[model samples]
Target: MHVSEHIIDIRYAETDQMGVVYHANYVIWLELGRTKLIEDLGLSYIQMEQDGIVSPVLDLQVTYRKAMRYGEKAIVKTWIEAVNPLRVVYGYEILNEKGELCITASTTNILVKKDTFRPVSFKKLYPDWYEIYVREQKNENIN
Candidate 1:
């Protein structure tokens, strides 16, 4: 499986009244991690948009496993959990400075026409991406 790591320095503004990281901020971190994974695969969302294709989140699921405080670093590990022609599932694990998992999440996204918001197939529009994701997904399943 292909995993991409992005480090985020916990900022004070990202914290809540309890002095731990805010829950909603984790969603943004997931997006950053997903983007990094796509870039690591040599695919650019910007380029896709220029081609009139836009990938939007169909659904998101996140679990808060632990609390994170400021002055700590967040290590976001992202990988392709599953993939299909029409949709992809990206998994994420956010760890604190000690490598303890703080969050576990997944987001399902689909490629759509930016103008009409109609579904499109990565297999048809970007076969290379589909093939790469297939390999990644297979690797994940093997382990």
Candidate 2:
């Protein structure tokens, strides 16, 4: 399975009054990781969107483990956890500079026809993309 790691340095602006990274920042970092992973595989999400197809997140889950402070580095590791006909699940791990786990998360996305906003099977309309997914990603283990 393909996996990518992107580094995110925690900036002052990313921290709140409590001196911890804001919750929403994790989501943003997740997106960065995801985008980088796609590009690493020689694909572009923007191109897919321009092709009249869009993959939107259907679900997201984040679990905070340790607090991350400003001026520290974060390692955002992303993996293609699962690839189905209509859905893709991505797994993530956020680690602090101390090499401690800060958060563990995942997001599930589904492709849809941009005009209809209705789900489309990736294997049917985008076989090339599907083939890459099938060959690179392993199915997620629920347990």
Residues 1-143 of candidate 2: C-alpha lDDT, one tens digit per residue: 88899998899999999999999999999999999899988888998999999989999999999999999999999988888888888899999977899999999999998999999898898889778978888674322
- Local distance difference test values of all predictions, in order: 0.91, 0.90
In model 2, what are the clashing residue pairs, if there are any? none
User: Taking the candidates one at a time, how many backbone clashes does each contain?
Assistant: 0, 0
Tens-digit per-residue lDDT, 1-143, candidate 1: 88999999999999999999999999999999999998998888899999999999999999999999999999999999988778888989999989999999998899999999999988999999889899887234311
Q: Runs in model 2 with CA error above 4 Å?
A: 140-143
Cα deviation of 77 in candidate 2 (Å)?
0.4
Candidate 1 stretches greater than 4 Å from native:
138-143
